[model samples]
Target chain A: MQKEENKIQAVIQINDLKKSFGTNEVLRNFNLQLNEGENIVVLGKSGSGKSVLIKCIIGLIKPDSGSIKVFGEEVTDLSHDNLDKMRVKVGFLFQSNALYDSMTVRENLEFPLRRHWVQKGKENVNDLIIEALKNVGLAETIDMMPSELSGGMRKRIALARTLILKPKIILYDEPTSGLDPITGKEISRLMLDIQKKYNTSSIIISHDMNCVKITANRIILLIDGTCYASGTYDELKKSSDSKIKQFFD
Target chain B: MKSTILKDFLSETGDLTRFTMSFFREAFRPRYEFSEFLKQCYVIGNKTLPLVGITGFIMGLVITIQSHPSLKAFGAESWLPSVVSVSLVREIIPVITALICAGKIGSSIGAELGSMKVTEQIDAMEVSGTNPFKYLVVTRVFAATLILPILVVLSDAISLYGAYLGINLKQVVSFDLFTNQIFEKLTFSDVLPSIIKSYFFGFCIGIIGCFKGFYTINGTQGVGRSANSAVVTATFVVFIIDLMAAQIADIFQIT
Candidate 1:
């Protein structure tokens, strides 16, 4: 009964996930839990398997042995169509923005809706596009191509595309990477606002201490293919452990 | 080292065969991407007409000029229309057009898809509940297979016109007489085999290009490698198909 209650509260639960590529073991016995309406930041150094963990969560990479349950359903056991259905409720923002270069901002926003056959009137789609752009503060660049946009503007457009689906959970891969300090802070604040407005859960993978400090409700330190430590930013910063102190220092 | 190369080749062949089967499976499933398919047809078919037409015209004119001297030596120059027509319709136009498309269309598809893969756009499509394979591969393959035959037909007509112009360049022969000579020698056997082989060529180009691009790795440099390999592999496959097609046509006495 208690386990059932925990499952009901958690939006995503991963246990003992293991993955390797050709003798290089990237993830081993990793575990994490994301509760509803919470922001969990995963902090790790370069090549520390943070990206692998995110990919496994999104079903982009198959784990060697483990269980990843999203909303009480096992992701590893789902078929292709079922996985696609699950992804409709979950949005992923790539580290490189991953905006379709061939498409304009409006078309990029319309893609997920068309793919999932989300039934909306033409006017409704227009309204949604406008509203999503408005949220990201780039409502004027609707017809512009991704190549035409600056790095920060491209990131905003990508976020708008993710928001058009109105997903219940969002996964951000290095949301503030490759940006100036001011832009990174602005994106971090925008992320916080979106979280409060939608009441959506999120898992952000990043090594940016400023992003982690600004956006993380809780931080998980991933080391040696597993969760080494997890705590609030302040709590982790106060720790005396050398590994955790290295990050805070 | 030789054995290792052979093993890798076999493995790649197996992977490609499995990819082909998966394409067929997804192609028949629900929610067909008809709009994207039509868009691809427009891009691959309609856009290629100018290049194919000019190449065909030049090929026909050159063949007539080159073959005329030999026929004149034997005093069989009057048979120029018949010989050039048969060769153009039966073999030259189809093979040349396929090779050209293998370089143009195949490389373009490879580079576009390879860049998409590198940038994680394909993964984005998948996560957004879009069938990237259907939207990307199936449409392109279907378009190529269906459009190449049409392109070949257009080329054949234009080349015959060029042949008429070429014959007129030497001595006066009415367009009516020249066309009549070609039609008299032309049979369904010659045309059908050639048209049939073009479909295989199109399929080979589409599939090879998709395979290379879809499985690309190592980032931007890999995109260049994919584009290069796609053209090279598709060109080689075109020749292999043409050779097999010739043997089959001969055994059936279609040529």
Candidate 2:
């Protein structure tokens, strides 16, 4: 148990993040700190830079100023190759699921593995793919095309893909946006289950209230690019402020 | 009416010039997306084959049927195979195939990539650390450049079948005699220059389509406009390139 004391803190840390596209600034002085095993839910309206914020975290978008550190390595000014190297520890779930439509699910799963040249020595990729699918409750679909899968099923396949790298942090962009309530609940539960099993930190971008209630260890409410409110659900619920109270009651 | 006409002319010209600059800038940038390149080959080369083949067959048959009476009147009906073969190999097939590709490949590429841009998929890729140009542009251009020549070669051979059939409509020419006459007139100059020009046709098609789609803005309306303009301009450019190549080859022959 003494080994727990020496464990590193803050798996991800961001300071005063800023970005602008033309005359419009999207993210303004956003700051966040996430512990090694915490699940932080960020809430925002559409086009409020929720996706943009996640993109920045994964090195997809460049923030104008400020610092971002993943696993204590500064990521603001990494070179192309170095940035890709950093991405090895990050698993991102895109909103559209973005599975290559022309390729089958097996090919989709095998893409990064082939690109990065991973090998399990002719034992077949079936076990690994099945295990990933099983984790997301989609074990029966390894050969289906993306076109054949329902939307919720596609999202699960995407989630399974995100788990392939066994990331230190999982960044979900609107993980349940288009899903029906029942399917959405399954996905939310799946995320919590995956986090607990892997003991990894998660930063989920969601505006779904029930999702916020079910998943957040802490909530970061974003308005105009900065945190508008920060607290636990219980603390947030007990508060008197109209904005924070309105979210729960 | 004059002002409207002037405005239309300016818009077209500005689009052409802007397209040129964007392609040049993107070409020099760092990210090289190799996977997108392979995907382009699959899309451009494989997908367009059925259309190219059908069009080429019809083209061959029509050329043979039309050239018959004129040659027969000259008492050079025996020369029908050679004449049609030479013309097909030297000009018609390559130009026609390229124009067809401009319609098929050029429009689809513009639409697909244009939609991706409008829907923020390109931005998603950029954020994902994938260089959209190497993945998107180079693959497409390389596919078009390589595939067009193969399509032209296939079309050339089939069109000759058309010429032979055309001669047999009034006069019988054996397969052996037809083949002999065709190669006799099919000089290295004719074949080489024709195939060489097609690579340029492919490049113009690919570059114009990619340029239009990559930089598209507005929304759905913009995507439709981009796709339409890409085909029209790419077709226009292909003909111009063919003319220039013909002129240059002629100069080479004289010099």
Candidate 3:
């Protein structure tokens, strides 16, 4: 039992994280852990600090207090240069897809690689771009502007941009929020495929149950800025507790 | 209520000081974004030249036409070019050109960055291991700072040509005579102080534009507010700087 437990490693660990804006407390005593090759869905309603939680992990928002240790390094303690170095290993997909309007899909993908100084030979960079686009099934969109693409395509291109670095961990903020049912499912499927292929750990913030079922290995209910309950889909669904059962409803 | 307004004003001033300090810090840091800076320079300088040129030409023509009668009434019709050139080069053209750019470039940078902010593009850049402030704000502010003086100089040249045309319209004053008369009366002090003040105008416009946009919040409405405020604030700052420059130039002359 001890040997089996030792084999399972946590890639991200958070303890007692707190963040507030003005008089409103967004996150209070939030605690979570994402293990190796596991997908944890942080399910919550709007303005419940789901997005804030992920942003804190990426060091975009400094938590008011507490620790977020990623790969055994304290995120809050890391310098700007060190934090940027840490970001190379972690990918974040914004809720808006956040594609640069002035850049083509190819330029958008190249931006991260160029800034991170990951630029090698032209062919090598091109090959990586093509591969990343292929993964998202949008290889033909290499030269297209983001404004020309549909919402679903833009999201895929955004995911491709995130994947270009081949990060060890990905933080997805509402990946399926604005999509149609079919497109949402497709995105969920792509998330599963990327996880399986890269063997990457992820913390996905979502309210979409279908996406949760399709991608999450475990579900953590974030109620009132804290992790209220955590379990698998079936286990949480069968819970008698009203707060946990509300999610199933 | 008065205290609250005062507190808000002080807070805004404090924030702007910090933002300006951050610009200096990031500007000298390694990994200078040379390509982006060049691109901003092209955008700010090249794109603004036509508008500046048209305004300057019209201004010189009107001023020369208006002043010709006054000088002629004083039995000094030959002094037309000298008077027009002195006023345009020494004061009018620089302030006008700077104000035009404050409206044009100031609003552009503000709206662009504000839209980027509200849409999460800036945050996206941050998470991608890129410094958005260096790529966006620093490049733009520096470009505006470096480009305005060049624009003012060009505007002065174009306005002088327009003034020459205005003189030709009423009576035949040969181009050579007009040129000689203008240069004969114009001193180094007249040209130098105007050119120097233009650099200050550019810096204030750039800083205000970037500061308004960098911290934009809310949504689409917020972007609109940022762009509008950028133009207004930059215009006001340009005038204030011009007034101060005039006062300083006066002190220098007295000493």
lDDT of each: 0.92, 0.82, 0.93
| Stretches > 4 Å off in candidate 1 | A1-5, A116-118
lDDT of 2 by residue, A49-132 (tens): 988888888887889998899887888778867876777688888887877666688766765454344556334566667788
Q: Write the per-residue lDDT of candidate 1 for residues B199-230, one digit (tens) a residue.
A: 99988898999999999999999999999999
lDDT of 3 by residue, B136-161 (tens): 98999999999999999999999999
Candidates in descending TM-score order: 1, 3, 2
Docking class of 1: high
DockQ of each: 0.87, 0.21, 0.87
Model 3: per-residue Cα lDDT at residue B139? 93
Chain B TM-score of candidate number 3: 0.97
Q: Which candidate wins on lDDT?
A: 3
Give me the displacement of residue A52 in model 2, in angstroms.
Answer: 1.0
Number of the candidate with higher lDDT, 1 or 2? 1
